[model samples]
Target: MPNLDLWTFALNCYAREGVETACLELQSQGADVCVLICAAWLEARGVARNQERMCVLEEVAAPWRHIVVEPLRELRQAWRSPAEQDEALRELRKTLKTLELQAERSLLERLQTASREWDESADANQWLSALAPKGSCRVALETLRNAAYQTQLELAGV
Candidate 1:
């Protein structure tokens, strides 16, 4: 089973302006691949949150606070029966899924920003490249390329 501390800490990295070594360290520490994928999606989206976005994240993360992190923390501090631990683990998985969906809303917003903001000569890509791992930059480059292709298609009215 995956560790909550590891997952929570890994998720925290998403709050940063860009992906860093800390983010990769989380991956190295056996974080779930699906969570990492969602994190990458969020990173591509970049950080721009309006009131509506903030509310969405809030609503999404709120319920999980109690079920995912809080209970797990309590259990870690004061052990649980095996059956209870099983239940908690199951709950944690569900909580993570909920958080992922909530995060997707913000991610979609970020991707929208990237689509509107991407520039060939702009420093934004440079800034992201500087902060992100090479693999991440490669993926971002691919996304940018796809976005450019779509733009061309639109221009051609196809």
Candidate 2:
């Protein structure tokens, strides 16, 4: 019943050795971690790359990330320095950071459900072979793709 859907794929992929740190680094550089997760998931499912599909994914994720997740992340990061002197605030910020991650997971779930229709591509083997990672995280993104694809293939045999 629980095959490697987008959310599961994301959790497993993000848990891979370099994936979480790489994703965080990419996020800091303005990449949407949710979108990155979608990219990996779609790749795993053999969904063809569609610019319109990509745009839809971005549109769905950006507002929640901006309005909910980023603020929490900003507050958490800003509190890191202050946490050095205040143990209570440090604990609170830690809780807030965990909440932020939960929000991101919710967003990831939304992305997953939204893109399930993409199982059948409108086209096959288009010019676009990969999702572009913004900023300097290309290496990290490549790592994610390789790991995700490998994981998908591995699990497919199971």
Model 2 lDDT-worst window of ten: 125-134
TM-score of candidate 2 versus the correct structure, residues matched by position:
0.85
Candidate 1 lDDT, 86-152, residue by residue in tens: 8876666556556654544444343334334322232223222333344553544344334333333
Q: TM per model?
A: 0.28, 0.85
Candidate 2 lDDT, 1-158, residue by residue in tens? 12466766777778788888888787777777778777777765667776788788888898999999889998999999999999999899989988997998899888877776765454633211244443456677778777777777766675
- Summed backbone clashes in each candidate are 0, 0
Judged by lDDT, which candidate is best? 2
User: Cα miss at 148, model 1 (Å)?
Assistant: 13
What are the lDDT scores of the predictions, listed in order?
Answer: 0.39, 0.75
Name model 1 segments beyond 4 Å from true: 1-84, 121-128, 133-158
